[model samples]
Target chain A: MRFNDKLRLAWKKNNSLVCVGLDPDLSRLPAGMAQQRESIFEFNKTIIDATHDVVCAYKPQIAYFSAYSAEEQLEQTIQYIKTHYPDIPVILDSKRGDIGSTAQKYAVEAFERYQADAVTINPYMGFDSAEPFLNYQDRGVILLCRTSNRGAGDIQDLIVDGVPLYERVADLVANQWNKHNNCLLVVGATWPEQMAKIRNIVGDMPFLVPGAGAQGGDVEQLVKAGKTADGTGLIVNSSRGVLYASNGPDFVEAARNEVIKLRDLINQFR
Target chain B: MRFNDKLRLAWKKNNSLVCVGLDPDLSRLPAGMAQQRESIFEFNKTIIDATHDVVCAYKPQIAYFSAYSAEEQLEQTIQYIKTHYPDIPVILDSKRGDIGSTAQKYAVEAFERYQADAVTINPYMGFDSAEPFLNYQDRGVILLCRTSNRGAGDIQDLIVDGVPLYERVADLVANQWNKHNNCLLVVGATWPEQMAKIRNIVGDMPFLVPGAGAQGGDVEQLVKAGKTADGTGLIVNSSRGVLYASNGPDFVEAARNEVIKLRDLINQFR
Candidate 1:
């Protein structure tokens, strides 16, 4: 099935648009879990089991695994998610960008190796870098538009012709690059005004909205500006805020509660 | 030592600016080697042994190894370079970009896990994405300015304040982000004219120039346009052209011959 169809199914089944970002930082893992070899995967499994019914997607940030030389764990984590919670799309949050040939290898890494349902890509290198991923017609190719970072405007807000560069990116991705109807934009929740503009440009296209929790993006503003007419377009992510909600033995329950609260909060505005 | 100091030492010792890109595709590996589990590392070893004396740096494109679940082989490849040819710097061609928090993990992946001397990053998300990598003061942080791909102009050539986006990148990277003097720009050999303008903007700052071999970049134009007044500002790379120069038993010798010819050709322009 195409990523969009799977996402719609997830949205309807869960009654939520929240994506729990499984960015398991070793230093911050729950009390006794940090010392184990399979901590990252174990932590991810616990999180998935706790919150799978409440979220539309799960985004695993590749760096968190690869940094600690735990790529096998990442593979296992995604495989476990696919095996158990297959309805929830796994978005490998690796913002990879390169030339065509190298990008092909990255596509293989994200899709074939990790078995991620969808993968995020950096669009700075343009169409060819994205082509290899787009060729996987069933998967999602989410492009970074207006990033959540404070310094995002350094490059993204530069005026091109008359519009901000991020707007230009939205126009191009929505019109020229969505041939497969699998392209999604990463419009940050921190910039609600820009998010609304991007929504205007890319009608009904889904967005992987990051920055709701630790990055201080307002859930009300994000939902008000980004939701589709049917109220099912945003995959709002909460990483540190959810995963490390409580570092004690109650971490799992805390995470589950946090995700439920976030999901309900998003639904309130929707 | 700092990345610049190490690079200068290697450039002086090797008498060549060629940075052979170790992008070992499994399907493209030589006869009798692809079936072996250690083929990627062995092939890299042969290439490094053959060309270490003539080249200033080695770039290992991370995707090729990670695509095949051979990241251990990538770690071994870089460790081998550092252990054997200690003078040559290894640039991890990752092109990773993310918000600050995730970027920290990527820095750990490149510097601590892979032990790369330098790493390439996509600067689309702006300064925060590059900061974690820059914090490692002794290592190199190479940012993509004008990529070598055909679709580079899609976002790079857009007018930003009367100048191209790439030029703006050059200005920002050179003036603001090079605080530790560890930042470099990736200007493709395919666009020699744009490269010349970048050189003018970031004077004497080194460039990691790809697109030299299979990408059909002209050596003469690339060198004439990218080289500094002292003729030492470029690390020209060749991947497929060098790695798959021959798929037979004589592949090693063919690769060495190709590197020598490329180095000499670059010298002619210098």
Candidate 2:
């Protein structure tokens, strides 16, 4: 199935749009699991088990796993999710961009090696960097438009022909780059006004909205600005806020509670 | 020593500006080694051994390793160079960029996990994305400015303030972003005019120039446009042309010869 259809099914079945970012920081891991060889996968398994039914998607930040030489754990985490909760899609939030040949290898890393349902890419390299991933046809290629960070405006807001660069990116992705229907924009929840403008530009194209909880993005404003006409076009993400809600034994349950709260809050606005 | 001083020392010691890219494609490996478990490392070892003296740097594209779950091989490759030929810097051509917290993890993945002396980054996310890497005061952070690929102009050529975006990137990296003196710009050899323009903007800042050999970039044009006033601020890279110069057992010698030829040709222009 196409990533869009799979995502929509997940949204309907779970009645949510929350995406839990599995960024397992070793220093912040629970006391007992930090020293274990397979701690990342083990912790992720617990979180996925607890929140699988409550959330629409899982986004594993590749940096956290790669930082500790835990690519094996990342593979295990994704495999565990596919085996146990096949309905929920996984987005590998890699934000990778390169020239054509190098970008092809990255595509293999995200799709074949990791077996992610969708992957986020940086649009800085332009179309060839994105073309290899879009060739997957079914996988989602989420391009960073206006990121959730404070310094996102450094390049994203550069005015070109009287419109911000991010708006041009939105128009280009929606009109020219979405020929395969596999492209999506990353319009951060922290910038609701920009999100609304992007929504206007791209119509009902899905958005992978980061910066909800830990990044101080208000759920009400995000939903109001980013929702499609049918009210289901956003995958709202919360990483540290949801993953490390508690550092103790109840971390798994705390994570689940946070996901539920975020899902319900987003739905309330929708 | 800082990356700039180390790079200049390599240039003076080796009398070369060549940076041989270590992008090992599985299908393109020499006939016998393709099926071996340690082929990536073994191949890189031979290439590095043969060309290390003729080159100023070694750039291992991480995607080539990570795609085949060969991160350990990448680690071995960089470690081999550091142990045996410490003067020749290793640039991890990752092209990574993300928000601040996530970017920190990527910095660890490059500088800590791989122990690369320098790493390439995509500048689309702006200053904060480049900050964590710069915090490693001794390491080199190369940002993408004008890429070699034909589609580089898709977003890079977008006019902002009556100048192309790549020029703006060059100005920013040369002035504001180089406070740590750890930043370099990636200017492709495929476009000499743009490279000359970037040279005007950035003055004598170093450039990691790709697309020389297999990518059909001319050595003379690249050197004329990109060299600093002192003629030593460029690391010209050739990947497939040097690495896979021959499919036979003479591949190692062929690689060395190609590197010598490229080095001499670049010096001729200088």
Quote fnat for model 1: 0.88
Name every residue pair that clashes in candidate 2: none
* Docking quality (DockQ) of candidate 1: 0.90
Tell me the spans in candidate 1 whose CA falls farther than 4 Å from its real position: none
Docking class of 2: high
Supply the global lDDT for candidate 1: 0.93
lDDT of each: 0.93, 0.93
**Every candidate's CA RMSD:** 0.9, 0.9
